[model samples]
Target: MRGQRRVWVAAGVLGAAIVAAGLWGIGGRQDAPRAAAQPAGIPVTLARVAHEDLTQNIDGVGTVTSLHSVLVRPQVEGLLTALLVEEGQMVEKGQLLATIDDRAIAAALEQAEATRQSNQAQLRIVEQDLQRYRTLSQRGSISRQILEQTEAEAARLRGTLRGNQATIEAERVRLSYTRITSPVAGRVGIRNVDVGNLLRTNDSSGLFTVTQMSPISVVFALPQETLPRLQPLLGGAAPVVAHSRDGGELLGEGHLNSIDNQVASSTGTIRARAVFDNPDGKLWPGQFVTVDLRAGVLRNGLVLDSRAVRRGLDGAYVFRIEEGKAQKVPVRIVQEVEGRSLIEGLAAGDEVVLDGHSRLTPGARVEIQGDAQALARRSQP
Candidate 1:
């Protein structure tokens, strides 16, 4: 019994020893990982904000419009014998565009001409008789009443000749109408009628349309609140520019033509037009484009790269670098020009992050790569 009790006590002691050894091994383990080292600062590009002369311009969407557009219609009713202009052909003012069958008009003109000639011949005979009668009266060989009667006959023949001449002029005008011409210098549009088609003055669809391409106009609108600034500039010949929607390509440059007399009630904007010399035909009619109207200049305006400005729940804000750390700074965007933004809150000489701002937070350590001010200093002589 004593030997068995000793054996059981030894077994309990052995088990406790093993369990304590395992616990010690885990507690004093030397292979465990250490706490992670602090992450390095976020790398970013920076630009030094500064005050510069910025143009206060208004940007808006605009539509291209032609200065003059006309529908070419025949003035006289006749069969279209010739089409002198083709679709999309540039034409000059008074250039012949079409020809009508003028045979009937020519016949009428010839008849009038013959009548005028016959009346002229009768007038000459009457004048000769009047002269002979006057000579006879002066010689006391014929009565004075007979001389006066011959004078009256000559005057009547002269009146008849004048009437025939007027008729001939009318026929000439009608004949001219058979040869249709462009009333303005422009590019011809689609042809509505072909040769052998009868054209009439009252035709709903005209022969064609002509649109003045060069020196074309663009119509746009701006907010009514901008009137105070735009109105003053309108009196002067302020310059306006048009660009592609992305603002990468310049469409054309022009000056303000006119502003609407009143603001639109529904839109709360005023319509305006600018005329551009479209010699290259870049600005086409009915094209929607971006319009930039230079109202005035804002001297000493704070500027920053447009990408630096970001929107959060609060509003527009920028990540500004201060003391090697990025700090959130609220900014009021006054204007955007040439891929840069004019901000209100930032001061001159302050640095702002341009790129890699997504991983930034307030008071975050930042390592700037492309510092614009630093590069400018390095470039200096």
Candidate 2:
């Protein structure tokens, strides 16, 4: 019975080994075909070369400034009686902004005027006497000495009248200073001196600041390297746009006005000013902003998406797609602005790869990803 059982076990082991070997051979055959198959083309996005006028803009940070900024300070010493305009009020040139105590100046003016009237009446009486004395001397009724003394009296009175007239004028000018007016057409700043406070001509703090807003100015700085390009745009109608510091919100539009005479040696930058007609009053002084100044335009430029231009060991180049294959083309970058690059060495309507450039090489096959909207914005001006 033991011999029969041992023979049966050996037969079962041999059958199991044969079935396992057959399964292993089938798995090897399936893997062999997959390893031999060629790789698929690299996925990429493409844009056609565009022939259009490409505008080049240089971007920099700037500050909103006022064209005319003046301190509204008192010209004479007096007690502040009233403030006609409130803080942050918009005022015109010569508009009354505040009033100082004018009683002292008015009293002095009245006193001078009264003295002038008295002197004038006395001078008239003396002149009549002098004229009669001259006529009497001619008729031999008055002595020559009397006529000369009368002439001297008339001259003295005339001098006193002239002095009085000058005092009255000086008093009038001092009285005018009591009424403070806006020196410029602009918005007022915070009041430094309150009503009923004493105001002095030499006060360190002024009453307020009046800054012109309608025609405001923006002062910005550009890199020294851009000086050559910036010189030609000065005094021209170079459009300047003021945007929020994040470069998203449109604040206002202006033009290049002036450039600083010398570049800042410490910062290697040049300061420039732009004038904007701020009709909407959106711009405020001391506000930081992003400025876009027109540098120049490329005529009939070979416009390519900025992403398509890649920097390699041999300088800038682009991978152009020709007949579904990436052909490496050397290019020169003229200008780049707003994600569009003005490039050379590519013809209009030629397609270039804008994305998935990592897997690209000369003559490598590519698979294009389609997007009408992206393609339109990428290439077309």
What stretches of model 1 exceed 4 Å from their correct place?
1-49, 128-159, 232-237, 246-248, 307-332, 345-381
Task: Identify the leading candidate in terms of TM-score.
Answer: 2
Estimate, for each residue in 194-226, the C-alpha lDDT of model 1 and write its tens digit.
899988889989988999999999999999988
TM-score of each: 0.70, 0.77
Compared with the true structure, all predictions reach lDDT values of 0.86, 0.89
Candidate 1: residue pairs that collide = none
lDDT of 2 by residue, 31-66 (tens): 878876645789999888888888888889999999
* Shift in Å, residue 71, candidate 2: 1.9
Q: List runs of model 2 lying over 4 Å from the truth.
A: 1-45, 136-153, 225-236, 312-315, 320-330, 345-351, 361-378
